[model samples]
Target: MKKFIGISILALLVGFFSANAQDTAKNVTTKVKESAVKVGDKTAELASKGKNAITDKVYKDKEGPNGETIYIDKHSKYYWIDKKGHKVPISKNKLISKQ
Candidate 1:
């Protein structure tokens, strides 16, 4: 009778450990899925911001008041032209120095 009781207790202990391991695996899988979703959202937001920055640069170069033209040079710098058709140099140092 003592031997039978010992075997039953061993079996119960084994079953309890197996159940606990399965619960831990399930929690880890849930956490990984949530982290993957958050990373995907951040990637999409960064791509959208990059596209908007390009569009804004193009719009600034093309749109202006009547008889005035805005130009962006190869160095990604900006300048303006007036109605008098004169070549005016805008000071890049002054523009960049401003906070």
Candidate 2:
């Protein structure tokens, strides 16, 4: 009778530990999924902002000092224009207006 009782107790302990491990694994999976969703949302927001920025920077080129032409984008960083209308990088401080 004593041996039977000991075996039953051991079986119960094993079942309890197995159930607890399963619950822990499920919790970990849920957390990982939540984190993935948040990261995806942030990426989408950044992409939307980038698209809007490009659309807002489209502008016409005009002549500047010493025959060097400047292409001005009211919403963008400073860019210079070549004879072929290609844009060249300029200093941000010179291009951007101080608020």
Candidate 3:
């Protein structure tokens, strides 16, 4: 029983060392995509030498049906884009201004 416990601890240490030595570069990448409006600047700058998503344009923050926050450009008509870039439409009747 003692031998089994020692062997288990040794195995755990070896596994931890091997995992630590594994290349982390491949595992690190930005999972976010940038649309016309960019929100992933900081991650991109860290990823590359030096870069960022900067814009002089302005956007408005809006809410989806389920209460997800979304950003909208000035030209965006009754629709807002979700994080996945999918459109979540808002009806005129359901809008606070319209109501």
Candidate 4:
């Protein structure tokens, strides 16, 4: 009886780990395609790891108040990302023109 119960638990754990294996293999491109939002002439995906925002696009020349180059997500939301990849909110004075 103990042998049977031990095998059942092991099988259950194996099944659970197998199922989760697929989830952990999710790639960046897959995530981008999942969250792709179109904005004007550009498209951006809001990929985040915790509080950190991820961007597939190269950092542009647009500068914010603190002189950090700005980034625009697919939602057209502008932010200044920091060294730690945290999306820092910009001030209203740094509002980006839609034009």
Which candidate leads in TM-score? 2
In terms of lDDT, the best-performing candidate is: 2
lDDT for each candidate structure: 0.57, 0.60, 0.46, 0.57
lDDT of 3 by residue, 35-97 (tens): 323655444433332111121121234344555433333555455444444546666445432
| Candidate 1 colliding pairs | none
Candidate 1 per-residue C-alpha lDDT over 1-99 given as tens digits, one digit per residue, 9 for 90 to 100: 999999999999999999999999999999999988778776765564454345434324243433233445556665554323332445444333211
Model 3 residue-pair collision total = 0
C-alpha RMSD for every candidate: 14.6, 12.2, 10.1, 12.6
Instruction: State, as a TM-score between 0 and 1, how close model 1 is to the true structure.
Output: 0.54
Ranking the candidates on TM-score from highest down gives 2, 1, 4, 3
Expressed as tens digits, the lDDT of each residue in 29-87 for candidate 4 is 57766555333113222233222334434235456665655666676666765544466
- For candidate 4, the 10 contiguous residues with the lowest summed lDDT are 40-49
Question: What is the Cα-based lDDT of residue 53 in candidate 1?
Answer: 47
TM accuracy, model 3: 0.28
What TM-score does structure 2 among the candidates reach? 0.55
Q: How accurate is candidate 4 locally (lDDT)?
A: 0.57
